[model samples]
Target: MEASRQTSPPDSISQDVNPVFFQQLRDLDIPEEAAKQALLHTGNVSAEEAAMYYFNKLENEEADGDLMYKMVFVVNMDLAMGVGKIAAQVGHAAVGLYQALQDKNSWREMAWKWDHSGAKKIVVQGTSVAHLLELQAQAMSLNLPTYLVQDAGLTQVASGSRTVLAVMGEEDIVNNVTGSLKLL
Candidate 1:
């Protein structure tokens, strides 16, 4: 009699998620349950598309008291930038990204949460311009705010050099992008 019975997981838990797609979103630090919901809600579309939808959905949802936000600066290691130069670049990235968030109500809310949560910040080393761009792309795909700093010729780096990439969002989501990189 038991062998004839059919059962399924709870409705809240999606069973049809694509493993590869799930892992991609997971790599971006989305919670396991949220990733499953994204896959289910988006009908298992491409990972990038699902991630974008998940974050966009978050932007419209009511703020949660426990949500943690953070900011990360990825310095261009290839530039051979001095400590002082790196400091200036990171400063620029922080202020610029902060200003960018003010334009969006949801982002402003996230920023407020971050500010009240000790405004956690991390500095990480990026291999090159390509690496920075790749990380920026991943962040953007997940709807995270990014600000890339460009150096002027008068400074230590060449004019138009991509100096730093700053990404801001929920702590875990932000970690999905820069967590693998080494600390600066």
Candidate 2:
């Protein structure tokens, strides 16, 4: 005789998330779990998704507010992209920026004591500009120059504009004067 089934099915909690948001996040390479969690908790999709959504919303409405910058610096990757995208903006504003090539000790040195001497330029090899900016803002109350170089590995600076690039590979980026660097 066949045994009677007694297993309970998994609970079906239909999350109140927009399907379009899911599609957008998926297209942006965001993992499903992270995207769902971000949407549930933050009331948005992935960081990139949320940023883009807000940015577009603002643009469509012709908004001129502080949140504009807030949208671009959403994720670490986004920040890195932004740094690469805005290196010229930072430089034009006269903020000095630097990126790491292949030194650990030098990077640590810069992270430790760049702001104490009023340095304003910083370089991040792997991390995004958002992470760097967050760190810099936390470290010192002063605004510093920010730059990001793609193809670098996991790098971070908790403070200072003179922080070195904690690089494990080649610098990759050549010209920092313009935003022509590949931002992957």
Best by lDDT: 1
Q: Native-vs-model 1 lDDT?
A: 0.88
lDDT (C-alpha, whole model) for all candidates: 0.88, 0.37
Residue 155 miss distance in model 2 (angstroms): 15
Give a tens-digit lDDT track for model 2, residues 75-148: 23343334454453334223223333113565434433332222323332425555545444432232222332
Q: After superposition, how far is residue 93 of candidate 1 from its true place, in Å?
A: 0.3
Model 1: which ten-residue window has the lowest total lDDT? 6-15
Segments of candidate 1 deviating more than 4 angstroms: 1-65
CA error at residue 70 for candidate 2, angstroms? 9.6
Worst 10 residues of 2 by lDDT: 66-75
lDDT of 1 by residue, 39-121 (tens): 87788988988899878767755454367788999999999999999999999999999999999999998888787545788
